[model samples]
Structure formats: structure tokens, C-alpha cells
Target: MIEANKLKMQLKCPMPKLDFDVITLGHGSGGVLTNKLLDSGVFKILSNPLLDERHDGALINLEGKTAFSTDSFLVSPIFFPGGNIGELAVNGTVNDLAMCGAIPKYLSLSFIIEEGLTMTEFWEILLSIKCACEKAGVTVVTGDTKVVEKGKGDKIFINTSGIGSIHPKANISSKRIKIGDKIIISGNIASHGMAIMSVREGLQFESEILSDTTNLNHTISALLDTFGDGIHLLTDPTRGGIATVFKEIAQHNGVGIDIFQSELPIDNQVSNACELLGLDPIYVANEGLFISFVDESIADDFLKTLRNDDNGTQANIIGTVVETHPKQVIMESVIGGKRVVNMLPGEQLPRIC
Candidate 1:
């Protein structure tokens, strides 16, 4: 009986040096396995001046006014139709800073790579990041990398932090918003969310859906040149889409908002997809788009200015701030009915950003 118990104990023990084939949850436990993955995969390739310090947060020194923002990308299927995790990470951070009326300048990238991921795919993602940085005219000054044991993580995840200089005279914030302000969207809604949904669910359509994940700093700068302080609020409708964004702005400024459904610019394909999936296009995410609130008198000029730009071809005034329903967001439907658009109680799509 004692000999039998000893043999069973030996059988139950796990091999310490066993090789992993995929990522496991243990890799994310911040243990030895997680550290090994980071040290072996990402850190070796991306060692740089800013990242070499290995600090909890990067030390960023800048001149004049500065804006800082950080974002993590966990969109599934990492590689989507029009963009991937790499491009999304860079653009996401850049746009965040720009939304604050900042001139995006530098970025720090950190990678959480899953074990068993192919080097070729990783290299491709890196290339995409390089291209995105070039397009945004920002330098990737620093970054960190870590790997997880097989089955311990998703395929790959990326986190990016960015710093930018706030453009002089570009005072934009929710606090500046007031009643009678006009709300303008840079372009169509729901494209990015639908694009990711199509890929994740293997849904094919007549026209290919592409993510609108591009840097908005240039278009924002153009608008700032013309509107400047008149632009009260500038925010990108990302994870929770337009409905959530309006609600946030309204709550922040202590005002009410009403949007006209008929005025929202949505692509036909996006509308069809949302209808089929029983998803509200208003609640879908948009990466390459933003909403601007400005004085009613400057609305026309703002619309014209946006329309003239390639990025704002579909720009339109979707709503207005009101003094009546403070801290509430309401929408006027196409059938002439008014309804409240509330914040999403829970996530509509997990890992969307």
C-alpha cells in the first residue's frame, strides 16, 4: 500500500521543463512563465532608449503644453480586413491624444504576445506599426515586450501610450459645451464595429467591410485652424459608439442632447449588417471618426470645412445640445418619434477595442 501511494504521487507531479504548444492562463498570472515569455520574445526585439529603463510608466519630457493617453488593443482575430492589432494600437493612441486637441508626437508600444505565435506574423504586425507611425508622423520612442506560455493567453495583445503637444488656442473639452451647441460627426458611423464583427463571425457581404482605423490628428488640426476655441468638445465615438459618446458629453457638461437619426451618416452596408445582426448602428464603434460640438453660427462653416477634407466627406450635423433634459441623451427617430439613448448597461461586443 505504501509503495502504491508513492507511485501515484510521482504520477501526479508535473514535469518542470515541459514545453508548451500554446498559451495558457498561467502565462498571464505575472509569474515566471509570463516573465520568460516577455524576456524571450518581445523584449529582445524592441529594446530601445526609452523602454530600456524598464519602469512602471515611461518618463516623457516635452516642451510647451502636453497631452498624454494610453490604450490597449484586444480585438479578436488580431488581423482584420482593413487593419490589424498593430495599426489599431498606434492609431488608437494617436487619436486619443488628438481628441484632446493635442498634436500627437511620440508613442510607446508594449506587446503581450502569446506563446507559440509565429515570428512571421509578429514581424508583419511590427511592420504595420512602423507604417502607422510614419503615416501619423509620430516617433515610436519606446516600448516593452512580454510573452506568455502556450494556452496561457490570447494570440497577442498590444498596449500603447502616447504623448502629444496641445495646439495653442485649441481649447477643447466637455466643460466648454453649452446649450445651443451644434454637434457634427466627422463621417459615417458603425463601420469599424461592423468590420470587426464580420471577420469574427465569418460573415461575408457583397461589399467588403473595412475598419475606419486611421489617424485623425491631421483633420483635427485642419478644423482647429479654422474653428479654434469655437470647438467646444471633440471626442471619438469608439467602443460604445455614438449613443454612449453623446451621453458622456451631456453628463460632463450638465446639458441635454438630442440627435436626429435621419441626419446620422451611415453606410448602406453598415445599416444592412446591423439590421441583420439585430444591432443598433448608433451603438456601434467607430475608430476613424469623431464628433465636434461648436457654436450654431459656425456649424455651416464647420460642415463645409469638414466636407472639403477627404476624411470628412460624409460629415454632417447630427444633433444639438439642449438646456431642457440635463444629463440625458435623446434621439429623434426617422418616424418622428423621440426616444432616450442611454449608456450601454453592459458590453455589446467584448474585446472590441
Candidate 2:
């Protein structure tokens, strides 16, 4: 098991003493309490020139094409095995931009807090947001905060919007995918979902499962720098995992996807937990991993280059785009039998992102 200390960023910003121990409705009233919360918590930890201006929004310069994406996070257990909702909010949006072949630059953070939440909990989440922004080399330019009456909302919910300039060499699109293209998974699958399940379901394994939640912008930037247009497309299997992602792409692009069960990458502990729970790892969620569809000629080189990176040590060529079965996904079993891999019937795990 990865140490919890290793999985989480050490608190860099110390918690400041506040007048109130727990939040109240007044904290969201845009009055003195709200100002105190922002000044002592959010603004202090995520300080920057643009954010310090305290404007309704930020002005950023973008020369070429840009990518914009936003998402809301609502996990049952705000604090999970490997990460909390704060980092997940930042990473989820950052990754969405990265998959668009963009270098993430700035983010807007918004929070919905429950009235009874302790100030200490809010401070910890802010520190995590600060750490995540610093790690991704992105700044929090603007945001909003609101507090709801107890029982009206979850402990806390986060929404993040991100914008970035597209990489010059990147030519990514689902339409770019074609027959003979190779599909490569960035790393082991199913880690993030199982990590959350372990905590939510009170299931215990020999070794703790850690969420694979980290920024993938740097890894993607390096790949774009080296491979250029040799890379055809990029996608992350977040909520519905690899199977759902492949099925969506195939149906949308009128293409066929063929995968091998033996080639799929998964950590042993996570795989075991999935077995015990009767879950298919391929349908599980992931945070830090991505799928790269590249020209077949460079498949081996692409796989090698990705494996050399820290985030891609467990990378593998899991599948290929084919023409045999249009608009469908087929997986070859470990015993060499084949079957259709369909879209998820319904939500396998809810609030997983």
C-alpha cells in the first residue's frame, strides 16, 4: 500500500485561527463572516496577482486556439482513501483540458459548503486546492463560495472551470481516429474507483487502494512536443472506464475497437478487490489515466516513450481500431474467445468522479 503521506500532499499552508469553529449561514451572506472566510482561507492559500485583484473574473491572454472545460464534483465521502474532493476538482478539470491537447493555464474554483462544517475541514480543502494548483502550474484566477443550511447540501461540493492554449503540434479529435490506429492506455486501470469504494462500502483489503489522482498536463505536453501529429487522438476513461470510452468513440466515429483482455493493465490489489465485489475493472472509473490513439507505424515507439514517464510506467497497448465490426467494441478473452463490449447498462458506481 502506498503510504497516506505519500498519496496526499503535505499541508503547506498552516491553518489560521478563526473566530468561529464551524460555518454558519452568515458565512455565506456576503457580509463580514464571508469576507473573513475568504481572506483567511481561500485567498490566503491560493494567493496570486490575478486573484488578489478581487474582480468578478480574470483576464487572461490567449494567442491561438484554446480549450475550455468545467466539471462539478459530488463524491459521497468527501475524504477518500487517496485524495479529497478539493484535489479531485482541480485534477478533473485540468485533465479534461489536457486531453484536448492543451497546456492548462488557469482555473476558476467555486465551493458549496454545508453550514455546520468545521472551519478546520474547509482549511484543509483549501490547502489541497493550493497544492493542486501549484503542482499543475495553474493559478486560481476567480471563484465563488456559498454555504447552505445543514442537510441541504453534502459536506462540501466543488466546481472547477479551466482554460488553456492548445498545443501547436496537436491535431486531436475523435474524427482523427481511423482503422489501423493503435490504442494505448496510460497506466493501470480501476485504481480510483476502488479506492473510493473501499472507504464508502467499509470494505477492507490487505493493502489499501490509493486513488490515481494527479495532473497529466506535463506528461501530455511532453508527448505532444515529441510525437507531434503522430498522435491521432487522446481521451480519458473517467466515469465509465475503458469499455465505455471505447464504445462511445466507436459509435460516434463509426469505427470498430478490438481489445485484448490479457493486455489490459490493472494493479493486483485493485483487481482482487474488483473480483471480490464482482466488478469489471474495465468498467470502473479512473482519474489520472488517458487513452492515446496513434498511427500504427509509431505504436511501439509511442508505447515505449509513454512507459518511460513516471505516470506511464504501467502503460500498455490495450487495443486497436479496426474495420471488421463497425460501430462496436469487441474484446478477446484471455482464453482467445471474443465477445462484444457494450456501453454500461447503467451507472456502475455513482458520484465516482
Candidate 3:
């Protein structure tokens, strides 16, 4: 027993300088480390006020009042349970504009295909892109394609740029958040992350997991139609999950967030798989989920409107913004304790859309 305890203690010891000799899958995870790499390495050199704000979609003062955003998709296993990379690329860009309270109008697509890729697979991806555009009420205005030598590139890589019209009454920003505001989550967390992980790791459960990759503009429009300016900030929990979103909001707004553990909506299968893998569902990616910051007075009405929509059936008021702790996120445990919900230090799962 003494020897076993010593072995466990040694395993638990922290290694401060574990340099990555080669690129690992986690670099693409879109978690804390990914953000750190981008901010420190790239953003530092290209520093500009516009990019500094780091909003989902760049809000530019265009003559025609347009919102623009771009995103690249490289999710491995290209195809997954609910959707594939094509659908993800389209929806991801569309939703980025929607998060800025814009109506997505047009999109430009660029593809990088590897040599020797099957034409059938490429056709299927194109079909998915077409279907996604139809669902989002957008058009593929123009596109470009290229093929790279085999082994030099993945089977496929997609980059999409989108343009949209901003809502007149919509000026959502994390900086507008106040202490008494409410935090609302659109639906269950960690479904997409788990689905991708399951397929990649060959983990099987009784119930099949599905990715929550869908266009959320419809739901966002519905909520905006009802609440208008009551919504302070809107963000979809994508790569870094709910914890990262909360941290960003809190830091940007100069406020703290306090969430109730029991109020978080999590699907049973997702929770079970997360537990088994020693992961926290709160820090897992969720493609089709969003967090809304709004005033406390209209919290019920907002939640009611969201629940009435199909995409927001599991919507709930999970937490509140506070002035205490200034720029941190805290979660009240189900056992009547509190824990700091820090931003993930590194990636949990990679190539998860």
C-alpha cells in the first residue's frame, strides 16, 4: 500500500516545462492554449484596435452597414454523427455574424483538398454546404478551390467568410453587462464535444451521441424579436465551452459571474461520458448552444420565449452577473460549496467542432 501511494503521488506531480516536440491535435482545440497562441504569436504582431476587441464578428463601419466574419474548419473524422465539416464551416460563420446581432446574407467559400481524395466524398461535402446555406437563408456568392499534394494537407479544409446586416436596435456587447443581469444558456452543454470524442476514441455507449452543429441565427432572431435591447450580450459556447465564455464576458464587462451547479442543463449521456473520461462537461465544446446576458427583470419572459422555440427547449437561467470578484467565474456546487470555474489551461479534446 505504501509503494502504491508513492507511485500515485509521483504520477500526480506537475511537470512545468513539458515542451511539445511536435504538433499535437490539441493545438486546434480552440481552448485556452489555442487562444493564447493566437494572441501571443499572431495578434501581437498584427495589433489593431479592431482585432483587439476580439468580437465574434468584426463590426466595421461599412457604407452599407454590413457585418463580416470568417472561420476555418478542420474537424477530423470530417463526418460525424449529426453533421460534417462542410455544414460546420457554413453554420460557424453564419452564427458568428448572428452573435453580433446580424442577419447573415452572403457567404464566400474556399476549399483546400488533398490529392487522391475520393470525388464521392467531396461531392457529399458540397451537398452538405448547399443544404446548410439553404437552412441559414444565405447564398454562396463566390468560392475558390485548390488541391494540395497528398501528405502535405488533410483530406479537406474549408474556409468560409460571411456578410450580414446588423439589427438596428441591437448593440450587444459584453462591456454592456451589469451586476444585476441574468445569464441564460440556450440548451444542454458538452453534446458536440462528447460526440466527436466518442467517434474518435472508439467509445460506445447505449445511446448514440450526436453533434449539436446547427444554425442558431433563427433562435437568436426569435429572442431578439421579443426582447430587443434587453439582451446585453450574446455568445455561442463553441471551442472553449461555457467556462471560457463566462470568463470572457466577466473580464470584458469588469464583473463576476456566479452560476448554480444544479441549474446547468446537461444531457445524461454527455454527463456519463464526461464522468468516465475524467472531464468536466462545463468545459467541453457545444456547437449549438449559446449564452445570453440580459436584465434580471425580464429573465422569465426571455426564458419563456426561448423555451417556446425548438432549439431552446432546454434553455434555463443558470446564473447571474455580479460585481464581486471583479473578473472571475464561480460555480456553486450542488453540495452547497463554491469552486472557481477557471478557463481551461489546455485543450480537453481536439478536432471537435
Model 2, TM vs. native? 0.97
- TM-scores of the candidates in the order shown: 0.85, 0.97, 0.81
- Please give the RMSD of candidate 1 to the true structure: 11.6
C-alpha lDDT (0 to 100) for residue 7 of candidate 2: 31
Q: Which 10-residue span in candidate 1 carries the lowest summed lDDT?
A: 1-10
lDDT of every model, 2 decimals = 0.83, 0.90, 0.79
Cα miss at 243, model 3 (Å)?
Answer: 0.6
Name the better of 2 and 3 by TM-score: 2
* Highest lDDT scorer: 2
Q: Give the candidates in order of lDDT, highest first.
A: 2, 1, 3
Q: How big is the positional error of residue 317 in model 2, measured in Å on the Cα after superposition?
A: 0.3
lDDT of 2 by residue, 1-353 (tens): 13224434465456777778898988899989999988988889888999999988998788889999999998878888888888889999999999999999999999899889888888877877777787888999999999999999988999999999999999989889989999999999999999998888899888889899888999999999999988999998999998999999999999999999999989999999999899999999999999999999999998999999988999999899999999999999999999999988898899887
In model 3, the runs with Cα more than 4 Å from the true position are 1-64
Q: Give the per-residue Cα lDDT of candidate 3 at 61.
A: 45
